[model samples]
Structure formats: structure tokens, C-alpha cells
Target: MNRLKNCGVAVALLLLSGLTLQAQDSTALNQSEKTIKKYKPFDANLQLRSLYIWRGFKVSDAPISDVDLHYKSKDGSFQAGFWGGASLNGNYKEFDYYVSYTKKGFTVSVWDINNFSDFPNANLFNYNNGSTSHFIDAGIAYKFDFKLPLTLSWNTIVAGRDTYVKANGKRANAYSNYVQVDQVLWQDEENSSLHVFVGGGFAFGREKNFYGDHPNIVNSGLTYNKDLVLFKYHLPVAATAMFSPEHKTGTLQLVANIF
Candidate 1:
């Protein structure tokens, strides 16, 4: 229940922030660094955000609760730590964490998930089964520059979860390719930016991709940001609105940073 409590606290805080503040979002919220400067060898951007997709928030099927904590360090290295709410139909559980690294168009990482709070209704519908499944993957990406502003990357599951979903779950694994891109527009508000994102992901299930191909999932949003000094930390604030074609809905997200 500790994980649940923490997730609840984080959600409450994020929702409360919406009430106390009114701002609009961008690049840092997603994967775009916003050409504030050029991508330098030793440049790193600290990120933090809470995403509330209109459909994700309202989904009676699968609610979306996500907290994004990522750090892109010098040498083009990146690491992201994430925690999300319960998944209704996926093998994911109360906690799913990942650590990834990238360098010069190449990337690799190890990911693991834990499901301690097995819901009573939890079945093949949604549950990783209070088990820990780990996997390692590697991939490469190309960054489009001075062109259409796009990024192309290829990845392989490389390995499967050591365990399977609950008895009501599928015995297969998840695998897919990811393609995403972002464009930065000079919006002039606290070094804010407008971004365009498009991604295609395919996962192989025990049965037949259990879910589906979900080939085209595109999102577009705006982000306003400013770095401020707060008790010895550089705080970045962002507000965003985006839409995905699959769910036929939109999302309004707000996130802040302290570095």
C-alpha cells in the first residue's frame, strides 16, 4: 500500500497544482529539449511532470496515472525513472520502473515491474501478478536536423519477462518498435515551445499482441517554461494540451521542475 499511498499523494499534489496555478506546457514535458541552445556534449536537462490525458483521466477501461522523472546528462546520456497507476488490462502493476541509457544514436536499458496490490478483479484483464519481470533491450535512433524535425529509432524486446501474467493473463511477451519526433517553435514565453509528436508502437502478446497494433498514436501540445531560482534550485514550469487519435480524446498536462 505504500506505493499506492505515494501515487495518491503525487496525484493530489499535481491536481492541487492545477487549482493553485494556471499555465500552459511543451518540449521538456515530452522528449523535445526545445532548441534553447544546441545539443551539447555535456548538456543535460532535468525534467519532471504529471500527465493528465483527457481520455486517460476519464477512461473507465484503463485510467492513466503517470509521473515522469527523467535526467538527460552530458555526453548524450539519458535516464528516466517512472511510476504509474494501476493498469486495467496490461501486465503492469502498481509500480513499473525503467533505467535507460543512450549515446550517439544508440540506446539500451533494463526495465522491471512490481505488482504488490493484486486487485480482486485483477485477472488477465490487467495484472502483472505481484511478480517481478525484467528485460533488457537495445536500439538505435537517428535525429533529423535542419530538415522535417523528426527522430527515428528501432528497438527489439531482446528478452522476455521471466514470468507470465496471472492465470487469467496471457503467457506471451511484449515487443515493438517505437518511432517519435518533435519540433520546437519559438514561442517567446519563458523560453516556451510548441511541439509536434508522433509515435508508432507494436507489442507481441502471448496470444496475438493481446492488445493490438496501435500503429498511429500522435500527440501535439504547447509548453511554456521559465527557469527560476528557488531556494538554490532552477525550477522549470510547464503546462500542456495534447490529443491522440486512438482514444479520440485530448489531455491537459502541467509539470514543474527543480534542479
Candidate 2:
């Protein structure tokens, strides 16, 4: 009887230990699930445009496409994303990655832009000091929810191939920059109604691209956006009328969001 009682006590102890371990495992699993739920929001989009144009420069004559995928923290304080674009006709291609942090109405972002198609060498890892296909852009933006919604943004090339010779005969990183201000004309949150935006860009860079060398209003535009429902799916369409007074040109673009 003593031996049998000892065996029974040992078995009970083993069972209790097993239950404690199971409870620990359950708690760990619950914590993991909570972590995943905290950062589970994801979004993706694709934009199709008839032509690839920026700030009045025609990039491609064929169809242009932009695809983006992003994940955000549950509190919306952090985000990371991939954005890629390519021309359907030819060699124009771009791949970019960005990470951002937001607080209140302000945001700061770091982006890596790779113009792989424009690289002379086919090697993707080439980061030569003199010439490189990768550029880093740093940006900050602020939105005011005052009586009239207004947004101000600034972006500058902080690294990579953005270089130019100054008047002092020194080669230095261009640090090309652009600033813009936008006003939201209208928006309806309940109905997902139309959106109207008006904005302008001032180039602080000498690059011959979007923000040209001239110190003028390089980009000014009015955009209208609305959704079209087809088969119970919502499709967004945007129309933009952009003009560059410094370049003395205007462009009209239609964008369709397929997914």
C-alpha cells in the first residue's frame, strides 16, 4: 500500500507539471497572435496610365504601370512598402522601397530609388562611387486639418548619383530637392465621394528630370478623382491637368486603378 501510494503521487505530480507546461505554451501562443494582430494591415494597388509623364517631361510613349504593396502597424505609426513602375513598351523601369513613420499630421520617410534600366552595367549590385543606379531620397510631410485642409511636403536626394559641379569647381552631391503645397478642395468620408486637389511644386535642384535646374514653379496641377462601381467592385479613376510654366508645357493624364 505504501508503494502504490507513492506511485500514484508521482503520477499526479507528473500530470500537474504537464498541465503547467501546456498553460505556458498557450500563453506564448496568445502573445504571438497579439503581436501579429498589431501589425496585420496590408494594402496593394496598381495604377495604369496611358503615358508616363512627370512634371511635364514625357518618360514613355507607351502605357505606364505602377504597382505598390504596403504593410502598416495597427496604430498606423509605421509603414513599409515596395513600389515598382515599368513601361509596357520599352526599357524604362523603376523599383523603389520606402519606410515611413508618422505621428499626428506629420510623416518622415526614407526611400531607395533604383533606376536599373538606366544603368550601363547589368549588374544589380554595382554601387560605384562615380556612377550608380541607386538614389536615396528623404522626405517629410505635414498635413493641417484646420478649417481648410492643407498639406506641405519636401523631398531631397540625400545620397547616390545626384551630383553636380558647383560654381567653385567642386563636385558635390546635388542634394536636389523639391517642395510642394496642396489644398484639398473637397472630400466626403461617408460616401467616398469625389476628391479634388490642387498643388504646385518648386524645384530646388539642377537635375534635368522632374525638378529641373530652373528655380521656378516646375509643377502645378489640378486633379479630380472619383470611383466607378462595376459588378459591385469599386474602380478609381483620376484625371489630372498639369502645367509647367518654366518649361512652357502642359500635360493631361488619365489614371485608372485596376486593383
Candidate 3:
């Protein structure tokens, strides 16, 4: 617990330092408000999300259950969550935790993918190889609330480290880029809406999976959203399919977010 606490403090300090650096750069360039001010998330809110998805449409056994903790504040966003699952005959397991921040329209995330379990379930394989290294990705997603209800999300990965697989051990350095376009299916302006997105990603440096091996990734998804005025809550449920050229067959995931 002490170690995790220290790491959290370090992350906070790093974020503060980065903000300071960006502010200095903006000052030096005499950047205008129009340039600096973009996609500001002004309201403060806390959201809790739960996800349950089964692989291959199997239901008699165990399924993946994830609980996410999210917070958006000060035009900045932070999220951290632990992922795992349970079977009717299985025990316990732990994998990765997500820590991320978004300032303006840009976002960065750190993933500590830990694989410290002794499960013999090959079908329930999680590629986290228990390495203590961290992965960091920085990208930007812009939404244009224009005539066609358009959103353009483009993210060029700045850097990544410590992605591990049990078979080949740990790949300490990795880089990738992702792009997704989101279209509004329906919306009521301020209260509620639904959206759909399709995007793909590619990794160029190193890989083991022969198919998605070239750093290629494709994703398509549909989402359903609704809001309750009395409860001040918003619900978004989505289904996503990610196809990597490296792996056989695609991985499907269902996610639900409650705010």
C-alpha cells in the first residue's frame, strides 16, 4: 500500500510539473485564449461504471467483471480501475489498473499491467505478464458539435513501456497510434443522446502476434445512452469489437457507464 501511495504522489507531481511546463510554453509564445481554450469540461461530477462481458458468448462459466472509478474536475479528468472476473468454479484474479488524465482535448494514460496470478485457465488468458513496468500514452480527441453531429478523435501515441506477455516475457518499449470517428445517433442537446464510433490503431516497433503483429488494430462499436433527470444520472451502454491482425478471431467487449 505504501508503494502504491508513493506512486500516486509521484504521478500527481508529474502532472503538476507538466501543467507548469505547458503554462510556461503558452506564456512564452503569447498564445491567444482562442488557441489555449478548447473543449472545456466545466462542470464537476463523479461517475461509477460497471462492466460485465463474456468471451465467445459463453455464459455457463465465468465472465469478466470490471469496476471503474472516474472523476472529472478543473477541466482535467482522472480515472483508475481494476479489472478481473469470476467463474462458478474459479477463484480470484487481478490484472491491470488504469490511471489517466485529460486536459482540454488531450489525454494521457498510465497502465500498470500486473500479472500475479496462478490460474490455469488458458481460455481466460490475459496478456499481462506480471511485469512492474508502466505504459504511458498521450493522445487527443476533439468533438465538433456541428451540423452533422460530428466528432473526430485522433491520437498519436507519444510513448509506451512495459507491456508483458507470459510467453515472450516483457516488451519494455512500444508505440502506437489510434483514430476513431464518433457520430451522434440521436440527441436532445443538453439532456441525453446516443453515439456510434469506428476506429483502428497500429503499432509499428515490436510485436509477437503474427497477425496484429504489424501494430494494426481495428475497432467498431455502437452505444446506447439515456439519462434520468430526477437522479441526475447518465447511462451509456456500448458494445465494441476489436480485431487485431496478430490474433486469431476478434475480442468482443460490452461496457456500461453510470454517472
Best by TM-score: 2
lDDT of 3 by residue, 1-259 (tens): 9999999999999999999999998886775665676454333222322322221112222343444444445445665555433333444344555566765555566554332334444323334424322333455666565654777766543432334344466344445556678888777765456666666666555553212344444555555555444465545555544443333345555554443
- For candidate 2, the lDDT comes to 0.76
Which digits, one per residue and each the tens of the lDDT, describe model 1 over residues 68-150?
Answer: 44555565477767544543454334444677787665566665433334343533223342332333344666666633335
Model 2 Cα displacement at 92 (Å)? 1.5
lDDT winner between candidates 1 and 2: 2
Off by over 4 Å in 2: 1-39, 120-122, 166-170, 189-210
Question: The CA-based lDDT of model 1 is what?
Answer: 0.50
Per-residue alpha-carbon lDDT of model 2 for 119-221, expressed as tens digits? Answer: 7564556555357788788999999987557888888878877766679987677676767787767766533333333333343545343356566677777
Candidates in order, TM-scores: namely 0.48, 0.73, 0.47
Computed on alpha carbons, the lDDT of every model, listed in order, comes to 0.50, 0.76, 0.49
Better of 2 and 3 by lDDT: 2
User: After best superposition, candidate 2 residue 211: deviation in angstroms?
Assistant: 2.0
**Stretches of candidate 1 exceeding 4 Å from the true structure:** 1-97, 113-139, 145-150, 154-170, 187-191, 203-214, 218-225, 228-233
Per-candidate clash tally: 10, 0, 7
Could you tell me how far off, in angstroms, the CA of residue 31 lies in candidate 2 after the best superposition?
A: 21
By summed lDDT, which 10 consecutive residues of candidate 1 come out lowest?
54-63
Per-residue error (Å), model 2, residue 244: 1.2
